[model samples]
Target: MSDTSLLSSLLNLITTATCNLQSELKGAGLPEPWIDNASLHPWDEETPSKKYWDARRTLISALGMMTAVVQNPREKIICDDLGYHHSAALNFIVNTHMADVLAAPNVDERIGLPVSEIARRTGTHPAKTERVLRFLCMYHTFQETSPGVFANNKVSECLKKGHPTAELPLMWADVGFRSATAFSATLRDPQTAHSMRIEDAPFGAVFGNHTSKSTSESESIPKSEPGTASPVRATIFEFLSRPESEVYRSAFAKTMVTLDIMNGALGYHDLPWDRWDKEGAVFVEAGASTGHLSNDVLSVVKHAKFINQDLPEVCLQGEKFFAENNAEAIRSGRVKFQPNDFFTEQPVKGAAIYILSNILHDWPDNEALKILKHIGDAMIPTSRLLVMEIVIVPSLSQSRSPPSAPVDQNPNDAPWPLPKDYGIVNRYPHHQSMEMINTFNGLDRTLDEYVALFQQSELELVEVHRIRKLVSIMEVKKKA
Candidate 1:
């Protein structure tokens, strides 16, 4: 439709609403400026009449106000909610198990299977499965790259088990199972919603071991084999394995990768490698693991040495990844990987360009300061440090296309009686991100937060860039 027609339609809708309200108020027998002045615009409340235009004014106000409210939103959630279920939504999440179905590595189109086939393969009901799949595509949860098939989104990718989007789903799924089996609420709180908080948990409360409850009712079952152990026992064994299990270690790596991604991780693939000097300065990535992007940097900055460093476990992963890559690279001879603990008092020398990716948010004020001081001490007086982290915007109120929901809590909930910065109230991400970080000793910081963190670390921000559009990259130099 043309703009003129669209405008005419809207004008008609408004005219009808206004006229209806005017008639209702006139009938209410209210004697007021409303009745006397048909010419008075809604805003002209300056002159009052014997009967204040209460009814007409209020009704018109609502009509006018709703316009502003409606126009503010980006996407209108369909009034009839989609029949999409939890797993249906999750399975559509990026890079997780679900991707295996809707898409294979090479074929990006719809899997061309009937509902029965899809259900049989995924173990879902035919009709319901088809409905959910089609429904998510409606909201762009996944795109129907081909008819009856789906592709990913930044939104969905952001929700992967490793992303901020991954937390609530994972947390609720794990705890929700326990709640269901509670069968009748063995405890109290018969009236209110169940409230429990898991904090500082990276990767959004994967529960160190998030798995389903045992279906086998064999209560007296003993450890016939450790592999057959119950979930609780398996959890205990995971802990017993202590940072060694591939699962636990993967969770750790996944969490950092997600954090870095959220904090605007800029991979080596995205860098202007053709322009960067290979030997200009070796890029030392502190806490780099698997060298996923660091290796890309090495490839790009051929003259620049790429150093990927992290803890022993991550170092091993990096070494393994590099070694695997090296088997191919050695034939071509490029890029090197080094293993070192940043915390073990190694002098930060020779590295002209140091990178800290998604590191500061994990520590509290004092500890973060200590790490910064270590970086400061190790840095050459003139060296530069590139620190990447999420800078909390003071009020997320503006971020909302239509603004936040009424129940949405304020970001700055005013910590006690202290000043905002002193209280650190604003450094928090949304409650969703907070839950994941709080499960562990991690946090999301603001610009002021980055400054405070940087000052402590003996680095001063020279310029800050919002990389990948979302992650804040701080170019810092040693404090003069």
Candidate 2:
């Protein structure tokens, strides 16, 4: 189809998807998302009907692709590729706590706050604050009620302190933005480009000072197998584990909590936790950070004894978290926090279920294979391993779209064909894979790669429970 025809078809798709999404929300009795007076809602809070959310996601994907399709070639190449400007603006807004300023109780939410007042409260120059806020407002992050005055929209409210996702902006603006600056350079450098070691990653190149002392010592740590060196180096976790890195570490932890709120809790929802409803059945959460996943499991799977394991510092934090949030579970001995390194042999043996949630993607194949092996060594005949992670799917490229066909030829299909990278199903996993690469020379794996890793540990892929978009619960068992 001609560019004009394609653009018209995309516009039609956007219109149709928007109408469907609105109808779904109305049917479900949920408020329509409005930029002017948006409210921040947690994922689990008054969860919308599945149909409504599915329509919402479809609408977003259609709108995004439509915008991409309509952009002129030069505009797409020049504007879409730019990032430094966005990073700088986001860094300014996050660092200055502009969202917090707008969310202040003293300020009238309806009237909003002027840039001068926000700048005064944040100790920033008014002009610079106005410029950045305006940029963000254009993208619907915040709302400009009138010229120079801004209010917190749903997106901006997420940046407020203590919100589940508040630290996300800060984490991305500080660590991710800085690391991304060196991404091209890291890829071009011969020594770093081909290396799977974390120290060779873009984050390591930019934030080298944060490297942990233990990482150097780990060079002497024996490899899991002979004739192969462990793909070990000072990873992002090591950097954050340092005493001086407490602030960044806290932000990172909160970021993980945000992810748990969004995707991790879904693990509890459509699974057969009832299978282990019998008393004394053990459930181990390996590499548990702050025990969020364990908490989710304990909330529903009452009969199981929970073991939340992580590194020394994370376990200490997890203990405090459980003490404060899940006091009864701790008091009753139903839940316990253990300091354990996953690289070492599993200390907890023969658990009914071992959950490795969002863990293996932090390492290369060699190290990931070793982690699986360690878990396998600890498993009994009936023990199961549940790996909760994204299974990256191969996406179709837009360049490979079928030859000029009439838009009406496929009435069964939407007026505009869904792009190869349509929806969060494809976008999120791909972005996360790139994030893994930037931070630790790791990657989100495809189903084939996961199956291969399972085989290397003498385990077989038993089942795959797709618990959420972009994430799946890959069940594995010892090979017969």
Candidate 3:
């Protein structure tokens, strides 16, 4: 396409998408969202219809495309290089609880709070806080009402401590930023490069406390075998358990909640709970942390018994959580907690449905295969395994292979000029894919990569259900 043609196409897409979005919002009686608006977007309260989602995808894609086309490549590269400052600023704001002070009961959203008062309330250096806030203001997050005063805008409201996504920034800014700084080192290191061990990931370079294994011990270990004693080391979770890491641990918990929120409630609602809620039905959740996912599933599958499995410590927490919040389910034996390692042999066999929600993506293919194999081994002819995680779309690929099992309508399809993966709409998943590499030497898999894993594990890819923008439910079973 010619330059003018490309620009015109992008402009047309933006205009059309924006119009559709406005129409959908008006039809739903939602206030049009603006960056300055302090109120939550309607989508936060209710899942958007397909029309709204499609419009959003197209709008974001076209805007990103237009920016890429217009911006000077050299400046764009420089901007990308300085992106760490974005993380640094976000870290400072979140750590100092500046958003909390800005959104305080006494604070005026319009007049705003002075930088000095914000620093005083949050125990931060006033000058440094102002500089950070100013940097963020350039990006239209928190707004500067006056020279030295800042206030909560719609974008910044999510940074408030009580907000659903508050911890998301800290998760990336503090932990993710530190880990990513060692990315090049991990790739360049002769010993760590080409290694799939979790301890060899970029995060290990930054915060590794694992004891070095001896040559004899390392040689005895089988390649990609997870439970073996070679390269004995603590994973990120173990590191978070330290007393000094309590703040990070708390942030990590809230970050998980943020992720669940981002995945949207519709993903859970669209599952075939009614079909799975039959008499004598069993649902096993592998690597289930504190039964949050089991709680979600149990809400719909009332008659189905649940076995939530994780490490022993996590199971203890799950027990307490269920006792306090779901006493009836616990008493009636509708929900049960079992301490089990997913890397080990399968314990709960012949389950009606086995769910590995957000689990396999934490490991590389070799490790992920082991996880699938265990579930495959335990599955009966009628069993269904749901691997629910981000199923990444290939940007350059043109193939739109039809799914095997039932599928809900998806709004991810992009037209000409837009990449097959929908460009900017897939940014989060790509970012997450990178995070998996930095944190666990893992990755978010493409659909093809997932199929390869399933085939190797003697499991068949039954179908895919794109439940949310970044999440999919891939149904699988033992190869027939």
Mind sharing the TM-score for model 2?
A: 0.87
Give residue 412's error in model 2 in angstroms. Answer: 16
Encode model 2's per-residue lDDT on 239-353: one tens digit a residue: 7867867777888888787776664465456678887657889988888899887777676787888898988888888888888788888889888888888999999899999
lDDT top scorer: 3
* Candidate 1 C-alpha lDDT tens digits along 364-467: 56666766776777777657777766566654122212223545534333211122222222233454245323242356777887887787666789887633
> RMSD in angstroms, all models?
16.8, 6.2, 6.8
- lDDT value for model 1: 0.48
Choose the strongest candidate by TM-score: 3
What order do candidates take by TM-score, descending?
Answer: 3, 2, 1
| Backbone clash tally (model 2) | 1
Clashing pairs in 3: none
Candidate 3, residues 1-480: lDDT per residue as tens digits? Answer: 233477777789899999999999999898888777776687854568788888888899889978998999999999999999998788777767787888788877877898898888987789988998999999998889889988888888888887747776656776677678778877777777788888878776655653322221232321232222334455676677777676666567667656766745665877777866889999999987777777765666767899999888778877887887788888999989988999899899899999998899999888898888888999998999999899887787322432233343244557656776789888888988999998888888888999989989989988887654468899998888
In lDDT terms, how accurate is model 3? 0.78
Off by over 4 Å in 1: 1-68, 71-88, 91-98, 104-111, 142-245, 251-280, 323-334, 396-432
Which run of 10 residues does model 3 get worst, by summed lDDT?
214-223
